[model samples]
Target: MEISFVRIDDRLIHGQVATIWTKTSKCNRIMACSDEVAKDDLRKTLLLQVAPPEIKAYVLTIDKAIDAYKNPKYDSFKTLFLFTNPKDVVRMVKAGVPIKSVNVGGMCYKEGKIQITSAVSVSEEDIDAFKTLNEKGIELELRQVASENKVSLMSRLDSLKLI
Candidate 1:
């Protein structure tokens, strides 16, 4: 499977992802890898339902996603992988997935999490996971939309002295 794009988006699949990023990725498939979402039948169905016309979509657990990636049957698939957190991205990478870079997007603010941007927030765990990904040489870019300029996530954290 060719991972056309990998994005860490807490929303998983939404208007911006279904419309903009999918188009920008030029992928024929969109796979959301999250254990939480995969176990929720309603959310999985809803996410797949919102997929762009002519594009296939699936919500799978990280393990399943990794297995699918290693499967030769999906060799022709050009996929956009979406995750809700950086830890999951790190998990996939550690599982032998050749994820060269990751687009950090739409991590909503929650209590105990520092707001990094209007659309992004991070907790101590998130900061560590992001640092790990960066240490492993994965490009972490922050962009909420396709038309916006890409900002280095690590740099933003450094500038704020959060890391």
Candidate 2:
């Protein structure tokens, strides 16, 4: 599978993803990789249902996603990968998925997390995962929509003294 785009959005397959990012990436498939979601039949079905008719969708566990990504049968698939958190991204990357960059789309507000951008909030664990991705040469970009200018997430973290 050719991963055309990788985004970390807490709300997996929402409006912005269904419209903007999908068109921007020109991906034919939307793969939401999360162990939690994959285990929930209702959520998995809901996510798959929301995808545009022209595009194929799959909600797979991290291990399954990694296997599919490495499998030759999926070589023709142009996929846009979505994860709920940076920790999952790190897991895939560490498992040897060749992700060159990742979009930090929306992390949302959580009890202990600090707002990094209007759309992103991160806790210490998220910060460490992002730092790990950065160290591995993965470019972390921050943008809520396709039309917006991409911001370097690491730079912002540095400027904010969060890392």
Candidate 3:
């Protein structure tokens, strides 16, 4: 239960994340929750190598990550839970990931997707998950970086108001 920061970024791991977030949050381990990446050991190795030696990188299936958090081994180390999309976030939420707040680090606005902020975008189904998490008292912050202003994802849910 030491994961303090959860971020949704489609790019997975990049230079800024391997450096900035690790330094900023003092996170020693990164648990990347993605079904696609979990099966790919080569990609996982690349991600692990990018971490600046002091940090540990773990690429896990969504289910494994949820299970891993419940293990007492994770209780000692502060981790950062990283996901590539809101769908994974929603799954983790439903599976009991024990996260309080989620920050929208990046979501590439695809065709027909509604962009709430430069950093936040939602498909119709994603909007529903956003509402679910919002109602459950999970704080959602729309920001591309730590310097960006915070915004509510609901405002972009096609005229949905303060539900």
Candidate 4:
């Protein structure tokens, strides 16, 4: 499987992702890699249901995703990998997923989370996970839509003294 794009968007498989990113990356498959979501049948079903009919979608755990990615049957697939948080991205990379860069799309505001951008908010744990990914040379970019300019997430964190 060719991972055409990797994005950390809390709202997985949303409008921008379903249309813009999928088309921009030319992905045939959309893989929402989240252990928590995979176990929730309702969320998993909902996510799959929202995917554009022309594109296939899967809600998978990190390990299952790794297995699927390595499997020969999926060798021809161009997949857009989506995660809900930075730690999952870190886990996938540490487990040998060849993720060179990640788009921080929409990490929504929550109690105790610092707002990084208008659409993104991060907690201490999130910052640590992002720091780990940055240390491993993963480029983290912040962009809502394909038409907008991508900003460096790590740089923003650094400016805010979060990392």
lDDT of 1 at 43: 90
| Residue runs of model 1 more than 4 Å from their true location after superposition | none
* Candidate 3 vs candidate 4, TM-score winner: 4
TM-score of each: 0.98, 0.98, 0.87, 0.97
Overlapping backbone residue pairs in candidate 2 total 0
Winning model by lDDT = 2
Q: Taking the tens digit of each residue's C-alpha lDDT, what string does model 2 give over 1-163?
A: 8889999998999888998889999999999999999999999888888898899999999999999999999999999999999999999999999999999999999899999899999999999999999999999999999899999999999999998
Give me the runs in candidate 3 sitting further than 4 Å from their true place.
156-163
lDDT scores of the candidates, listed in order? 0.94, 0.95, 0.79, 0.93
Q: Count clashing residue pairs in model 3.
A: 0
Q: What lDDT does candidate 1 reach at residue 79?
A: 98
Clash pairs of candidate 4? none
| Of 1 and 2, the candidate ranking higher by lDDT | 2
Q: Which ranges of candidate 4 are over 4 A from the true structure?
A: none
lDDT of 3 by residue, 34-86 (tens): 99988888988887778778887889999999888888877877888889887
Q: Rank candidates by lDDT, best first.
A: 2, 1, 4, 3
